[model samples]
Target: MNLALLHDSDFIDHDRVRLTGRRFAHLAGILKVELGDQIPVGQVNGDIGVGRLERLDNDSAELRVTLDTPPPAPLALSLVLAMPRPKMFRRVLQTVSALGVKDIWVINAYKVEKSFWQTPWLADEALSENLSLGLEQARDTLMPQVHLRKRFKPFVEDELPALLQARPGIVAHPGTSTPCPSHINRPATLCIGPEGGFTAYEVDKLVAAGCQAVHLGSRILRVETAVPVLIGRLYDSCAN
Candidate 1:
């Protein structure tokens, strides 16, 4: 973890926090921190700053913290993605968060297996843990929101149009004629499909819902790879 993410529960007082569990293990074991040392810390959805270690033991540690700097600006992008395989979903979630995608929609596609949604990683606790790992990696504190829509048609017909009203929508398909736009650096919602890509009927629905179909050249990238590439391509926020 690059920055120790602080939760409200971690605080004992306005300026003090107690660390335990994975965080304590990392600091006490991996970082091998000494008393009086300072470490980077950020409060969730709050500011970034440093914590000075005042006490330490095998089970826990205490830090006096000061938060002044705000976290990095979030990307002006909304990601609409087909649910990925269980094995890959965790990594994809972290990557999306690290890139500063604050809005995410995980919808079902024709190729997406129903079993994918049954994964424990979708549990609330697991989602928070993975997102926290991503935030810590990026030294960011803002948590990304994940919206799950199991039925594709209803989501496209009902909710997508409203989301598109504020941000233009783009669907990434493998053979589409239009290349994915680069450096738009504006608010947009991007849809990506499962491993085999969205079926013709599914693509039509998304297109009808006001999404422009675009491609990332001839190469087909896995959802995990495409997410970061697409975000980097579309947002100077990520690059900067």
Candidate 2:
């Protein structure tokens, strides 16, 4: 992890922050942080800053923290993804977080297995742990908010309109008249499908909901690869 993140509860005393549990072992062993060393630090949902290691023991380490700037602005896009298999789900979460997406919706698809939803990783704490690892790796403090939708039609037909008010919407499909734009300046809500991709009926629903169908290219990409590539293209477009 590039930045050591702490929760408000983790603080032990003024000018001294204690690391216990997994974080302690991560610092002492994985990171090999030394006393008097200044390490990157941030409070969860707060500012990014530097922490000076003041003391260390077998159980914990203390740090003197200096709060600095707030975390970077979140990506300008929100994602609506069809939930993948459990194994792919973990990677997708991390990938999106690393790319700085702070809003995500994982919805059920026709192709989605019921068993996939039963995975322990769907639990709030487990999801948070995976997302936190991504944020920590990226040196970011803000955690993405993730939501799950079990019904496709109700979500697209009812809730999507309100969500689109803040941004333009696009749905990635395998074949579309318009290719995915290289860049986009405004905030966007991007919907991507499962491995088999969205059914024509599903794509039509999203289109009717104000999402324009677009394609990455002729080539089909797995959910994991498509997410970051699309995000990067959007980011680059905005930059130009």
The best candidate by TM-score is: 1
Please give the range of 10 consecutive residues that has the lowest summed lDDT in model 1. 231-240
TM-score of 1: 0.98
Give all candidates' CA lDDT scores.
0.94, 0.87
Candidate 2: tens digits of C-alpha lDDT, residues 188-238: 999999989999999999999999999988898888889888888888632
In model 2, what is the error at residue 114, expressed in angstroms? 0.7
On a 0 to 100 scale, what is the lDDT of residue 187 in model 1?
Answer: 88
Cand. 2 Cα-lDDT: 0.87
For each candidate, give its TM-score against the true structure: 0.98, 0.95
Which stretches of model 2 miss by more than 4 angstroms?
237-240
For model 1 the local lDDT of residue 226 reads 92
